[model samples]
Target: MSSAAYERIRNNPKFDKLVATRSRFAWTLSAVVLILYYGFMAVVAFNPTLLASPLGEGRIATIGWPIAALMMLLFWVMTGLYVHRANGKFDEINAELIKEATKEAQ
Candidate 1:
């Protein structure tokens, strides 16, 4: 694409909104993952016994195992969520922005 096209898109409010929305979403997801993982680590560091406790009277596995698994699953789910939103909403807006930019340039 030409510099003019790039400049046109860069100046578009839709382009700015796309960047802002994507950045906010990515940061939010990162914060959630950090909080969850760090919180888990903090618990393990400060209160190891809590995470070490068995799931039930006779169970061998600790509760932490499942919680950790869930955290991992959460990361995957968040990834999918971003991908879905990017493909559906963000991409649509981006295409529209490009079309507008091209029209404006022409």
Candidate 2:
């Protein structure tokens, strides 16, 4: 693409909003996942027994088992959410940006 095309997109307000919204959303998700993962790790580091200890008197499962499962589920959910939003809102803004840029180029 030409510099003019690039400039047109760069100057578009919707382009700025798209970048801002996508970046903020991505960073927020990253922060949440990091905090959850590291919070679990920190707990393990400080309290090893809490993770290893059985859930109850007769149960075979440990607390860590469910937590690990939840973490995996959280990762999947977050991924799905990001994909859904990107396919919807992000794509819409992107298409608008392209449409506007093409109009300007012509």
Candidate 3:
């Protein structure tokens, strides 16, 4: 709550590790989603017929439909993965840092 406590947390090595690890994970997930989305868009832009084509000889659905759905599901899974790690490992490290800082402040 105090500035000194904040400074103490900021100066902690665990705090730096937490920030670096979380940022790296977030960026990695972001890059994966971006690549998937943009790659799909590129396909749609350059090869519309490929995506537009039907899934099978008699199927009404296009191949792109399943691909898009899978991409959406994958994104959700990635989100869950991030949340799991954040709530687990990240939170543990954060709690430790906070407790340490508070103790040092006292």
Candidate number of the best lDDT: 3
In the order shown, what is each candidate's alpha-carbon RMSD?
1.3, 1.2, 1.4
How do all models score by TM-score?
0.90, 0.92, 0.91
**Off by more than 4 A, model 2:** none
By summed lDDT, which 10 consecutive residues of candidate 3 come out lowest? 97-106
What tens digits encode model 1's per-residue C-alpha lDDT throughout 1-94?
Answer: 6999999888888888899999999999999999999999999999999988999999999999999999999999999999999899999999
User: Looking at candidate 3, what is the lDDT of residue 71?
Assistant: 98
Q: For model 3, what is the error of residue 97's alpha carbon versus the real structure, in angstroms, after optimal superposition?
A: 0.4
Candidate 3 residue lDDT tens string, 61-97: 9999999999999999999999999999999999999
- Least lDDT summed over 10 consecutive residues: which range in candidate 1? 97-106
Q: How far out, in Å, is residue 39 in model 1?
A: 1.3
Q: Which candidate is the best by TM-score?
A: 2
